[model samples]
Target: MISAHLPALQVVIPLLAAPACVVVRQSTLTWLLALLVSWISFAIALTLLVQTFFNGPMSYELGGWAAPLGIEYAVDVVNAFVLVIVSGVSSVVLISAKESIERETHIKRTHLVYTGWLLCLTGLLGITITGDVFNVFVFLEIASLSSYLLVSLGPDRRALTAAFQYLVMGTIGATFILIGVGLLYMMTGTLNMADLAQRIPGVAQTTTVRAGFAFLVLGISLKAAVFPLHYWLPNAYTFAPSAVTAFMAGSATKVSIYLLLRFFFDIFSETFSLRTMRLDLILLILGVIAIFSMSLVAIYQSNVKRMLAYSSVAQVGYMVIGISLATTTGLTAGIVHLFNHALMKCALFLALGCIVFRLNSVDLKDLAGVGRRMPWTMAAFVIGGLSLIGVPATVGFISKWYLVLAALERDWWWLAFMVVASSLLAVIYIWRVVETAYFKTGPVANTEEAPLILLVPTWVLIVANIYFGVSAVDTISFATRAADQLLSTF
Candidate 1:
């Protein structure tokens, strides 16, 4: 009976921990509990993923009622893979949260901060595990509400404005999704995703279904910060506390991308989405623009955090490109980048967190000579940058290789070239940070390195980057399985 509830436990463990953190009210205790909860969630994700591989899809009915009536939690390779990444990254980032929280958040609000963190974690996991379409919207809002509070908790006043902007955009996005879900319910009479999929084909050509699809795509695009709709991301990431930035950077929009894949491939028939709607072409055009424009924007950013934020938008572009191809190879690339980019961006942001620990600023000029003072941290940043540049034997190279191969498989040579060319932009921006940290001398003569706690977790992600880059068989295997599961739904 206990074993039957893994999906429920995956989300409930974190959900329950949120209140415990508040009740404890001691920062240290709260941090420990949060860390433990995150790791437990990660363990659950691993278990669920293994179960899926061995047992096919596993479904857990809420209140012991079957689907289309009672809610269900479904696990397949697709979401199980994402569950692992989200929970894994959250656990790693929480390891360093104590120091980062102390440095960047207010002392009086520490308890509330941990509470919000756990709530955000709960929401994200819930979103990934839920099998009901309406439940997706509910969990998405839970994550969104907690995230706004998390962003606003930063010591910087700009964090307030950033949170507000994110709130406005996020609210609009949620509203659109809700409306779309309502429309679908009106037409299909069921909210369970599997049930809905079984029903959608009967009315796929109806105006209501088409409108629902449109709203869902636009709403999800806004949340995912797809190009031309990404105005809220840079400020939000730049102004949030470093730890907050790291967790969100590593997982948030990636989850949104997962939703896109889920909806496009699973809920909606591929014939309707790719053939009739022609979303493939739309995503392709936007993906290309995002890759070039966001990368170029990243190159000119003065703040290192802001530059990385823009880089994230560009990285999303790469994922969108994979989605546009609508082939197994393309989807595999998208799914792999979802994991790989999380590794690189989290490593980069955590490195920035280390720098912020000592220097209190991540502006390009402020980073001058930081390499000498904080060699380990700067070196981590450098390695992460190389991965961002798609150098051979790094996770980025593996991801971009798949992307290029997917493009060429479609005979889109220009797209193949664009994939390679975008990495050049990554190089320029990464070099800016590297040059400032290594070549120029700081005005201050003496400085200390980041604490071991922060340094250790940062290096963990760094090592993962190199390790996964060099030995990608396992990761690629997972991606291929997830891709097959997605495409098979069609």
Candidate 2:
């Protein structure tokens, strides 16, 4: 029975756990439930990925009703990859969050926090697993709503303001996506992404199709915090609880990028949007601007979390640049970076979570010279930072290598140079914190490191950064295959 309904179980396990969380209503109980659900999602994601890789894409109609008429849960290499990212990262972050949450969050709200975490996990996984466009919007909202709540959970009152700011921007982005989805449905009379892909091209020349494509891309850009649209990110990350910030810094925008890739490569005809409308050039130019501009901003930030937040904007440019190249190699580079950057950033943020848990601050001044006292934690941070700088033997290096290779593949020499230059900017920004943590002296001298509860997860991701960096074949292969799947449509 479970075998037959694995697709349903993939999403249902976390979905059902949300209510079970409310029923438990005790902080420790809720924490255990949340951890169980995340682990369940992680197992199911792995099972689904295995099933898809071995068996090809899998689809199950709700109530056994076939689509384009019925709702469907689906899995493909692209989304299977994403499901693994979301669930796998959430599990690691949860172990660390257990300690961070207790210190930073109110005891009374701990149960609510766990509930939101489970729902957010479910919503994010649902977005990746669903086959229908309307369903994407629904799950996007579910995740966004939970995200707002989580961001506001910090002890700082500024977290409330940040959450509100994020909510306002998120709502606008979601509305735009909904309208785009509605436009596609109105034109094609179908909501299934696969079916819409089949139908939209029949009417691809219409102005409405063009408009829908524009709205959809723009909406995704906003949700993904692409470049100029990233105003809400820094504060939101800076003020959010360590656990929430760590999880989101790694997962949220990455999910939005998945949606953007799906719509651009699958649901819409690239000939119309990229060729006729010239979105490729526009995206390329904006991507370059984002890479440099945000990296420069990152260098001067006083707070470590906010700096990383800006670095995320810069990373978005790399993914966009890969896509704008409009080649299999280019898309493969972008997709692989999506996976690589998630691991690297999650590790970095988890390291920061340790710092925040111990020292109660992510400020550069606060991190001063504790490097010796918190050697393991700071060592993990430095390694994660090196990964961010694309150092020789880390995940970051592999991602930038692919991005550079993609640029050269397009004969875009200037783009290739820009990629290198962006790496230089990354070096400058990552160096700031390194300087503060290791070079400068602290005010008092005896500040200790965060406990094993947090360090364990941080180190897990830190080691993962190096492991995936060294063993790049699997990520490269899956990304290439997924890119081929996407480029075939173009």
Q: Give one digit per residue, the lDDT tens place, for model 1 in 1-490.
A: 7768999999999999998888898978888999999999999999999989878888999889999999999889899999999999999999998899899877686877888888888888888889999999999998999999999987689999999999999999999999999999999999999999999999998999999999999898889999888989999999999999999988889889999999999999776887799999998999999999999999999999999999999999999999989888999999999999999999999999999988889999998999999999999999999999999889999999999999999999999999999899999999999998899998635878899999999999999999999999989999999998898874
Which residue pairs clash in candidate 1?
none
Tens digits of per-residue lDDT, candidate 2, 429-456, equal 7888888888888873867777998999
CA deviation > 4 Å runs, candidate 2: none
lDDT of 2: 0.88
> How far in Å is the alpha carbon of 13 misplaced in model 1?
0.6
lDDT of each: 0.92, 0.88
lDDT of 1 at 23: 85
RMSD of 1: 0.9
> Which numbered prediction scores highest in lDDT against the true structure?
1
The RMSD of every model to the true structure, in order and in angstroms, is: 0.9, 1.2
